[model samples]
Target: MKKEFRSGCPISSALDVIGDKWSLLIIRDMLVKHKKTFKEISDSDEKIAPSILSARLKLLESYKLIFKTKVPDNKKENIYLLTEKGIRLTPIIIEFSLWGNSNMREFNEIDDIEGLNSDKTLIIQTVQDNYNSMLLNFQ
Candidate 1:
């Protein structure tokens, strides 16, 4: 589906796809937290409403950020996995984490910045590698 955008600018076009309040968090849940199913995602710490979560999942799928499929053992249960496009958001997620860690510390107690000083490329690569490795057995 051709997505309607508010403007032709690259940032605006990108936001047109993932600017919603819930979309990035959903991607973070899948990409970082490794959430796979509707139930698993819904049961996350964010406590996203079922209706909103359903809509966000469909929107992400329509944008080609994630694909839904069922594992062989449970054809009735659907699991969502990131596409290459979605995996590309890893750096953004990492950046957001660092930004939050440095700027939003008053709101959150997670001050573990041990890896923040590490080579950023290495951090992003590690996440991508782990995600790809996990998908090796995904049918």
Candidate 2:
């Protein structure tokens, strides 16, 4: 059977792929923190299980949000990096972060709201300035 979207709205289409709580967070980690390895993603504060992390990575790859590339020096592990389509989500993630920070004050103490706000803008601009810049730069 073929999968279907709930509606024709662009937002709906996007939500179909990334509406889940974990998927967006996975993308954020890859796009912002440059975390490529399964260990890195699994070890996040969310403490996503290895099995779930694997599934999310596969789903993201299927949607073309991310791509797997062989490590230049190490053939053992493949690095996951965001595609242009995925990088486009930086702003959305930033907005989500901002909203969460504002509404969920009891969650955690944000060191600098101003800095986070500024970083959000900067991150969005950086992604826009160079799409390829979103790719993993380190091992």
Candidate 3:
């Protein structure tokens, strides 16, 4: 799908595509939670509605962030796998999680990434490594 941006600013353009309510959450479900199929992605804590999930998946696909394929055992069902572009967002995702852990903790519980590493650099490296390994399946 063609996108219409309000401005040429880097942050604005990036947000124009992914700044919606459920876009980043969907990406986080795939990246950090390792959700692949429609069912799996829908089974997130945020409980996104089917209609909104469908639209966001299409938008992500149009942007080449993810690819959809039929499940080997179930052709009727599709598995949504992240592309290189999607995997490249791992660092940003981690940053959001850490920032939320720091700032939003007073309001909400967060920081599952702490299970991987308390050190920021170490956690980013670990998640990036995991994302790369996952990309191998697509390649």
Per-candidate TM-scores read: 0.91, 0.82, 0.88
- Comparing 1 with 2 on lDDT, the higher-scoring candidate is 1
User: Candidate 3 at residue 124, lDDT?
Assistant: 70
Identify the runs in model 1 with alpha carbons over 4 angstroms from their true place.
1-3, 111-114
C-alpha displacement of 120 in model 3, angstroms?
Answer: 2.4
| lDDT tens digits by residue: candidate 3, 16-85 | 7788868899988888777889999998888999999999999999999888998777789889988878
Candidate 2 ranges with C-alpha deviation above 4 Å: 107-114, 127-131, 134-139
Cα TM-score of candidate 1: 0.91
Best by TM-score: 1
Q: What is the C-alpha lDDT of each candidate?
A: 0.86, 0.78, 0.82
Clash-forming residue pairs, model 2: none
lDDT of 1 at 41: 92
lDDT of 1: 0.86
Top-lDDT structure, candidate number: 1
How much RMSD separates candidate 3 from the native structure? 1.9
Q: Write the per-residue lDDT of candidate 1 for residues 1-139, one digit (tens) a residue.
A: 5567899899999899888768888988888778899998999877999999998899899989999999768898999999999999999888988788778878778758557768889989988898888777795
Error of 3 at 82 (Å): 1.1
**Model 2 Cα lDDT, one tens digit per residue, 1-139:** 1248899999998888899989998988887677877878888888898888888889889888888887778889888888878888888987887888787778777545445656667857875555455343443
The alpha-carbon root-mean-square deviation between model 2 and the true structure, to one decimal in Å, is: 3.1
